[model samples]
Target chain A: MKLKNEQEQKVKAGRYGKNFGGQYVPETLMTELEKVNKVFNELKDDAAFKAELHELLNNYANRPSLLYYAKNMTEDLGGAKIYLKREDLNHTGAHKINNVIGQVLLAKHLGKKRLICETGAGQHGVATATIATLMGMECEVFMGEEDTKRQRLNVYRMNLLGAKVKAVTTGSRVLKDAVNAALQDWASRSEDTFYVMGSAVGPAPFPEMVKHFQSVISKESKKQLQEQAGRLPDMVVACVGGGSNAIGSFAAYIQDPTVKLVGVEAAGKGVQTDKTAATIERGTVGIFHGMKSMFMQNEDGQINPVYSISAGLDYPGVGPEHAALAECNRAQYVGITDDEAVAAFDYIAKEEGIVAAIESCHAVAYVQKIAPTMAKDQIIICTLSGRGDKDVASIAKYKGVQIDE
Target chain B: MSNLAQIFKNQKVFIPFIVADDPDFETTVKNITALAKGGADIVELGIPFSDPVADGAVIQQADLRAFEAGVTTQTVFEIVAAARKETDVPLVFLTYLNIVFKYGYARFLKKCQQLGVSGLVIPDLPYENRDEIVPLAAKYDVDIIPLITPTSGQRIQKIAKAASGFIYVVSSVGITGERDSFFAGLSNLVAEIKEYTDVPTAIGFGIHTAQQAAEMAKIADGVIIGSAIVDIVAKEKTNAPQALEKYTQEICTALRTKVEQ
Candidate 1:
């Protein structure tokens, strides 16, 4: 009887709270997921793995990314002080390297010879390709045909890094379709390849695994904030696409009820318009892409083709953990329009001399709203998850100024 | 006895799978009647999903065509209701979990009972997560048909022990597709599964030809053919019902011929 109850409990082990994230995959991959889950559980706490991973982070990816006071914007807002967790300073120019380094090591430990990745705006693709080159593993990336057309430079970077990039033209030919293509590839190649998910979405262990690797962002920033400001910030803000960076930014402070966590989702034009990717705001509870979460799908459960000016934040769903966080009222999610995000993208670069990724600018846009309302003593730490170098050309195009390809 | 028990009463079963409303509703009902005329012991109706990650290019295209025709969940249910008037072969739905989930488990299962859909082949709904739907499925007299793959290993006993109707034994290492070869030790895998349950097992994925069907029939109690039929539907779009029936006849005739030998 005890064994039976334990087995039943095991079925619910990978879930977040009560309603999100189970291994909703084919039977062949279910066994493989179980194997990966078991390995991840063991290595997440192992001292040898930690030492090796820290060595790579410190030496290769240039760990301990800066926590800078955005003094110009802080004074201009004339209300709360603002600090930026500058993940943009990482070697790969994004927080994605943190998760990539960890998954690559885990895959290597499992004797995986090849790596698969799916990318939207291509920061994650570049990070995966960069690490695969460093680790001497074969790598392939699936990007949507539309994304490849926009983010051509990163395509070249992945190619230069010795990874094959395939343009997926299925579905709406965007991030979701790219994920679908990678999933199909992973389903077939689970024997010799490890799928390095770029975000905290997809099946279980992936959500937890990506968060575990990215928790470094919170761990560093929380300590740095304490040193600089003498206390935890009153609010933590990060942009949500598939929400890897947001989850990482919130992980360390989740237990502190006083620390308010906010996730800014990209609303392409406006939530009132059909063109929006604000999943947490307009989504219903449904399952897609291997995890049960809030999805912007039709009533019939067909996933909607979502839109966002920043390709990285264009997914129709948020991560399962984010869904649960919103459900249990641990985190509050809000939307930022494309216009607002673009204006903030320009403002952050001009004010702080920091070109934040358009995805991260959503958080900055939200800050431009609420930062002016709070008291001067309260602090807000916004995670600058990626540098805006890749998005500069697209931003120019969106502003009716085109540069040569 | 239920239609599921009736299918495996005496002979080796031949199952053919096709997406409902690939072209339109009237044609889907017609295709069902033709498949029954072609000696299908059971018919698996795929409820087309926008993202069919577990399927290869053929069925994926079929799903796209269904959506292009504006096929909705209600359209699929209506097609099944229309097909029921023409044939009484056990109807099973091959759907993703989200579709049934969005429709609500209780609501979807009640519809299944009403439509005479005896079983559900949800590829994503594994035995570990079966309890979420199994009790509901049982309440409505619907079998949540469980899948056991070549890689299931020791977990096969745990899954098979609770299975009803039949066990979908995936013959290959990956998603459903046409393959010239199957995973090694599939026969031994089937033998191992039989040690735990009285439920019949059907070998699916990659069995495209009559020769392949006869070969697979030697190992398992049933053989399921899908992608080949879906590919044919893609090839003969307007004439899919007749083409599907003729192809089903070929697969059925070969299985009986091999049995007589």
Candidate 2:
């Protein structure tokens, strides 16, 4: 079937869903971003690119994760039906492989021999290291010293993958600090090294390109939803850290005006409280990680330190495009407190036998509040961005309960 | 026409380079006006960025001093705007690309235009990056001046052709500092850039003495002195404005000597 006129114009106009995606960076880097974007656009329909990506996705990442419906949770919510995308079944155990495959290929195309990335939860860092190892490119990951201590197993896993993980001690000693260190490294060694940002943020082509890579999530979800139920979901909810998973799940659905998009941010205590990473709710516009975006910052323009029980959601800023979406009212920003997120994790696990990552639990908590009030047929898809396996210790600690196993 | 541009077109153009808010804000304003009074066609005000990797120690130290004096991007703009009201000499701001990019390219240009700035000299903005700026400059009536060095080859002509105003021909590849002799290679470089375009060229970087300015004035359209004038002002404990007038007169008189001889 032919796409509608507005749809065709929207695709051709390249609004990319508002003025959110464009080259806003240093003149030197803007040149490179434009070059990469041009190449990526031309190769979008190239059969070879698709085939190459597919080969890696299947043989390497073990693609085509099962789509399972949570019937028990659907009954408990007493509203819209929910289905899991099962990205947690990927080889690295998350959807990060999708982006890593795309970026590693892009690096090879760009003739770069080294890959650098920053990670807070260590999932993106490990995924990047995994791809770099497979591609035989030198890999380096910058993580906050505190995060290195918190996510030690993932640190070990990255080291085992032969990627050197550098502990960043500057700034707030968290994700934003790690990003600062990574950017500093990239600036000095930009000629030979490609900085693979883990999320849809940073200057320009990064936010756009990373979103494109991860859009496969929503693309697959759309088809899965069509097969399961003859229509699209009314709302799509996901957690926003640097907003990788949120961008992934929401990118394909952005043009659908009927679909309400909700981005759940980690309000450590609450939006009004001191401890939080709710950049959209609490932040002002500023530069961080080489991009101009809404960020929690002090009067001197330094990024204010943020706190969240979930390391993944402890960043001081969200993606610039996400900020734009909120501004345009195309997307709504909601904050989930740490305690409520913890309760949602227990609620989902006990009710549906689905233990969600602390970051993903924010989305789960949003669904718990929003789903009950919706009509029976009004569907809500909560993106299970990651599994809870990494957060088992945190969950145990939160409940004052210890896991012997 | 801006008084600076008017004076530039009137006769043999005279320009003096100084880092803004150097030593302190008070000295900066005094030095700028002194240079203007001493027949300076225009003053090239340098906005110091945290990382000035391209500059030499003298200019770098001047930049550091300016920054230490609590000079910020907005502060520099505010100083220029205030200076514009008092002096007819049009101010040309020199800076790196990062500051402009951070301030938003369109907004920065708009602000400069509003502040009555006649030109801009960004060392990092290459020929390719001139697409957006070239048009914006025309719209705002601000000239985007391109810098060339003694090492400029065929690309010098391309840069000169792309240039909206005069070309800033560096005396050497190195940063701004005081030097005794103006090398023959520099004159040859200026002559080479001149062969391709008719735009006036100003020779700068490492030029210190009267003989050096005289030598530069022999080959280039104008001679620019930065570090020497800045160093004198930085050294004197008092009467910086008077010292600036004395030094600028000395340099201008030296250039005039070369013109007559």
Model 1, stretches more than 4 Å misplaced?
A: A1-12
**Pairs in steric clash, model 1:** none
lDDT of each: 0.90, 0.76
Q: Identify the runs in model 2 with alpha carbons over 4 angstroms from their true place.
A: A1-18, A273-275, A282-309, A315-317, A392-405, B1-261
Residue pairs in collision within model 2: none
TM-score for the A chain of candidate 2: 0.92
How well does each candidate superpose onto the true structure, as a TM-score? 0.97, 0.70
Q: DockQ score of candidate 2?
A: 0.09
Docking class of 2: incorrect
- Kindly list the per-residue Cα lDDT of model 1 for residues A219-276, writing each as its tens digit: 9999999999899999999999999999999989987878999999999999868899
Candidate 1 has a DockQ of 0.77
